[model samples]
Target: MERPRRWLEDKLWSSFGPEQASANLRQALSKLRTALGEDADLLQTDRASIGLDEARLRVDLLEEVVPGNERIELLEGLDARDPEFEDWLRQERAQLQAMIARAGPKEIRGILITCRVDETAPGRDRMTCDVLSNQIGENISEQVRAWRQADPDMIGSTDAPQSDVMIQSQLVHEGNGHMLFIKAIHQPTARILYSKLQRIDRLEAIMQSETEIARTVFEAADQIVGKLPHVLAKDRPETRSTALSRLGLYRMFSFDQDALREAYGLMDQAFRHDENGLYLAWSSLIRLTQMMELAEADQAALMEEAVELYYRAMELDSDNGLVQAIVSKVRSTAFGDTAGVMDLARTSLERNPTSAYALKSMSEAYMGSGELQKAFDTSARACSVARSSPFKHYWDTGHCFISIACNRNDEAIIAAEAATRAAPLSRPAHRSLLALYAATGELQKAQSVAEKMAKIEPGFSLDAMVNDPAYPVRTLRNKGLLEPVRGLL
Candidate 1:
């Protein structure tokens, strides 16, 4: 019997192949059937019955060859094979058990449909049912009724053969029924579906219109400016100038002096006694003086106008720090005076000590005026104060720069490293690292830092560094920084 069983097994093995044949056995079986012609059914039955091994081999083969409805049918009838089928059944059961074990607990409990129709049609016969608490169910019914009334044809006609449809009805713990029905008509053609999706809607159309209008306005403004020089120098320059003069003194900044003076003369003739006109005239004069590089006269005039603007801005909002800060910086730079700028900055700091801009200005002013210790102290304080801000790295880098300047090499290295970690992309952080590397005689480290800096700022040059008025060239030269890397620079 074992000899006959072994002969049968060899025949089965020849038909079913090896254990790994389960992988694509279905495709092989289909080809075998097609090749065997009239004997295909007998071969299939023989392949199906060479014990559980053959049964399992058949199950795997069926899974691949028949899909959807036929696959479900084969699975349903799978248990009706011989008694030896238990082993193959055990294998499948174990596989399913493993899959379930891997799935763990679902976040939500519900039925999951693994297969569905690809398309549905409008208007055949359909039924929808929902199980829910009475009140919620009634509410849903009312909404459905409303939907039906609003688009009765669409709702009624969504049952066609080959229509696109997805119907999901879920019941929840709160006694609510959620029913999702998606249905569409069979597309006339693939091209029609593509065209429908690609078409722009009303909102996009409106945006395109607004963009075109903005472009037209900018072009018109450019054309006006291009025609100004010709119009202001022609035979009827006075009339044209008079019309342009009405645009106010701010307009003078937009024109050349000759064109500006002509416009101004027209304005003076038109409204000589008006205070606003006088203010405009004075403002234009001050601007022209600045443009001509009459710095002494422009400084006096600008100071007066700035004071007036500051007062006016204050009247609008007395606590406006931006206006105050601007007035302070202008006064400081114009007259070489630090009193106003320092006072204003200190006041702002008292209110919001973490204001990075004010802290930066105080540091720069102190540094520029030969007060390295004061600059270092101010920057350290700023770093401490700005610890909570997202821009803390900026203050950290500032403090590191000051530390390097004050010859605190260890402290500077630590600060520079922290700055790089905090803001890896910051130019100042990399520069500070380079400076620290050069100071510590780490020539290779300094070269690496320089390479990183050059990658970020491709236009950076040693010539630019030497000519930079802000940096101390003497100290840079003395340190031999950027000297060895001259060829790369």
Candidate 2:
């Protein structure tokens, strides 16, 4: 009795008894051998000489007859005599040569030819014939001459013969051929090299070219805006209003309040009669309001243009979460009204449960309201959503600042250290580190950090620090911060 076939017995014939399974296994093995192109004599002899159990064990022995890598060598040996293989090889070689030719003429100052010959043969006699037959030496000289003629700026002589030609050859006893190596060097005068450098000096010529292309586009846009005022003061009030509303939106970035006012007046004129024009006017008003935070206003105008833009944007696209979120942030920050902002934030969170921006906004609102724990929770959620977000620095730095504010110096130091590691280039991160060092009575460390900040922004000064908006000097002083560095300042 013989052992059973593992795959056939376990999977296909597992339900059958041993004898029946063995019979099925034999039939399956026969089909596989025929499909694999095994000779009938070898298959029958092996099958007949062994019992079912023994034959199953012999399968592993038969598998080693053809190794994977040797199969390719065997295929190549057989292909050498096949006409189909010869035609295919010729076609592939021609395609490769064509591709090389398409790359165009390349400069060749040296040539290397390698050949293997019978070691038992006379070395000098074998090399003499091989050198004469090989066209490699001639091809290299031609390439060098062509290259010199094509580019006169190239550092080489066109008419002179190669100054040096070196050859190295190797012989293998078992192989039928010898290995030959050749190198050729072209010589040129030193003056040619200097000329090449002079040709490259023209790269700086671009600085003389005028940037009129960019200036022309700006001038055309300005002309269009200038014509809008006349068009808006027309009989067709609706058309005029639409033009004015568009102009108002365009003037938002211009920082020209007079132009903005003129555009606004035209928009207002259109809004009185055109509902569609009202939305545009309102949207422009919101953008303008957002830009006014740095203006001379003592307090941010909450009931003014920002709210109007939000309402207009909502009217145009009620489902736009981005517009709703911005509007909510402006209302909360400008008016110091967190209740409405919190509710809007929650709504935004419901829409995009995993949004980092929404989470960060919620955290900011909490921080604004002096709700430290809530801010931390919201910030943690934002970090979970986007660990590598630049906003993470904002949250981490804010957390550190809050810790400092509460006189938790150790906790503040830990958070500040993490923020600095996360974004070393961030000014806020360095500022936090400076504050942490100063609070911990590390004046030298604070000064070192301040020096780094000064290197990044040369205008960073103690006088500028006194009026700095991001982290004010008064706040630093009140927190018992920068006290040690006061002498350095």
Candidate 3:
């Protein structure tokens, strides 16, 4: 059955069942074809025989190829009633197991589709796509080149002539942003080695969408680089990309202006050098946060830029759960569109129910809509989910708000303190804590927190913040449930 040189159709079918030879073989092939989708041709078939498509399907039963160190477990939990068939399967498994023991994870060749794939995609420009292809291809090629030079055992290259492996990728508009998909394929046999999907969320009122593209390219490079070992002992451009990628998540934990400026600077260099939607998204968030310190006149202009940045990010990949939550919260502000806020919150939760950010944002939306019980339940779940996340501050803050609404002052204080501790450096976390203390008539504690906040931000005054246009959100909360303690602040 294994030998393909002779007409072994009957022998191959004999291994599976003891029935009409031709019928069973045909049935099995048909089922396999259905499962293979576009790669059904890998199971080559002729009128007189059957064989593997060696040209497109390379099966390394020996130590030859490994795709991203991925283990392909075969015939798992499979059972056969026939003694002969079961014995044959066992023999095959034993042989494969021996090969596996000798084989190591060393990537050879891969492909990168550096071309304009979505010509018909709405809002997509051919020239822009071509430029993007060059930027992305070059950066990825450099990273892999650096890695390969460090690791002598790896045999493949993305830029090598007649490379054994290749990567195909494309960008398409999705929701408010865009999504990028990449598939690695073996060249000799045209078999998909591996694939990945990523969301690029940032595109509100973007002037230079190309920057977003460059950022995502570097972001994708970081993903690939992570799977492979440091081909080089030293860091390269890919290392910088890694640092930038984590900035977005890190922002939720720490809100240091100097750190944000450094991250934004790195993002700008990378965009000028390579761009991604997420970079723009993070930049917009940082800009919005900076608005608190800007003069009132400059606030409007900066916010407009921030909105544009967000729009651009969204056009690239709106499905980003954290971005969705951020957008939802932004739209919930006094100057924001309530309908837009609700829509984003609902969609964010739909995409990721366990997302601490999404759940926290949705809970706030529920609270704003007077759904007190629902808000408390959602906030509770957010806290539970966030216990293991970097942005636990979000759920903690949500809990503080919802608990206060339910007149649960003790729980509110505890949750507020938790938020403060989770991200002590975060301005929002500190603000939430201060608000809870002041609203509950904990004048002494409020004074202590106010002093701490003063060190974080000079001239800390609740009245001044609420009156600031950039702090419309603070005003909204103050006017609503926090009305009881207005004079205390």
Candidate 4:
């Protein structure tokens, strides 16, 4: 991501005055140019910003890791004798270590398939289950191998024996038929990345024709493989575009001003690497989330950029249910198009009913359109469906707000607590908890949460919230259920 020259000075030369920092940066850039005498053009610079030619650089920190290079230190022998530089380097090293550890062993592996049939099933049913499991597994494995081969990031390890994805199938007999469950688990997070449940009405149908089942399996495999790039991006550094997008998500979830800016920059870089519509959706979401979190933030630029990104994402992938779900989330905030937002959310849900993301968007749209009961109900469903998923915190946060809107303080408190546990740095989560606690007359707990929020977001205080009109005091007051907390704030 490119950095504004002023940001660079503040980040790297924090110990120096503004004028001195600028001069020092100039000298540092001059020295760097001299050091890279033959490749100076790679050090890109404009009047206000500085960046590397990212396209021409395969930064080891963001690229594929060698099979046995986990122990190697980043920039092993390089050091700058400055406190800010040391802090930045240490942070990068720690983040890289965390990513590698999460990725598990470096040895390449292929997808592992496992099947189970209920031991109490009839002998004939068991036999049928075996045949179906093996056939489906074989088909899925073939497609997975083909997918790995086609991916530029996994070019050389296409023949690995095992995969990061674990496809598990379980068959259990019902009264007159059977239920088949297939789920793809991303090993690193132990999360079910994709799942499908099917009912077999008659065993004879399977023996006579496997066409319907085959088509279902094929579609499941396609969707499973489609999710791999994103799952791997979080674990593997080499999937640069996906990695940036994943990191951006974490940063945005923090709901901090500086972190939101960093998230935007990361998503921007990721979009440049791969014009994936989802990246644009994520970027737009970051903007909207930031505006919603910080009541006093300048909204004009954020709103404009968010709407533009949403439209661009639609142009790029209008049919993608996930993309539509995400972009629709910003519509209510970005343009106050409540009806349009609900329509988009409905379309997204129609395209992918199983998507918890679409459900979350729909819940928010319902609230925007003054359907509080519908918002609460949909938010609850979204939370239920997103259980143990990678982004469950997002749904939980939505549920917290909807529950509060419905005067369900206890439920709102539970959801808010869960959100904070999932993303401890999130200002919004802490703020919600603070309000809930205060409303319930848990003054001590509410004050503690306020302290935590202050730590997460500097300058945040109950006094400021009470005195500042731009703060969310008015919105919280309008919620009605938070009446008891208004005096406390």
Find the candidate with the highest lDDT and give its number. Answer: 4
Q: Which stretches of candidate 4 lie over 4 Å from their true place?
A: 1-170, 174-238, 295-297, 480-489
TM-score against native, each model:
0.32, 0.35, 0.47, 0.60
Q: Per-residue alpha-carbon lDDT of model 1 for 247-343, expressed as tens digits?
A: 3333333223343454445444323222122234333443433433223335566556544544454454334333344344444545456665677
C-alpha local distance difference test of each model = 0.41, 0.46, 0.56, 0.70
lDDT of 4 by residue, 1-489 (tens): 688999888778888899999999999999999999989989999879999998887653554432134686667798776777788889988887776677543332334554444456678876666555554454444323222222222245545454455555566778887787767676677777668788988776554434456445545554554465656644433344555666677678777788788888888876665566778888898888777766335878878888899999889878776787887888877777888999999998775555567778899899888998999988887787666544567778779878877878899899989988888887766777887788788989988887787787778878765556667544455675345545666
Candidate 2 lDDT over residue span 226-342, tens digit each: 333232223333333434454554443232335445545544544543444234434554444434423224323434665665667567544433344555666664567778778
Cα lDDT for residue 254, model 3?
Answer: 63
Candidate 2 segments whose C-alpha is farther than 4 A from its true place: 1-326, 405-407, 466-487
Q: Rank the candidates by lDDT, best first.
A: 4, 3, 2, 1
What is the C-alpha local distance difference test score of candidate 4? 0.70
How well does candidate 3 score on lDDT at residue 36? Answer: 93
Query: What TM-score does candidate 1 get on C-alpha atoms?
Result: 0.32
lDDT of 3: 0.56
Evaluated with TM-score, which candidate comes out highest? Answer: 4
lDDT of 3 by residue, 1-489 (tens): 234423343334455333465666678779999999989877767665677766674343321221112254557777745555566777877766655444332332223332323455455433344444444444444333321121112334455444333445566778977676656444456665446676766432122433344334444444443433222111233333433344433542465666555545645543332244556666676666556534235767777877887788788657665577776765565345666777888987765443456677888888778788898987887776556445667568668767877777678778878878877766665666666666667777766876787788656676665455455345337435344335555
Q: Each candidate's root-mean-square deviation in Å? A: 32.0, 36.9, 21.7, 14.0
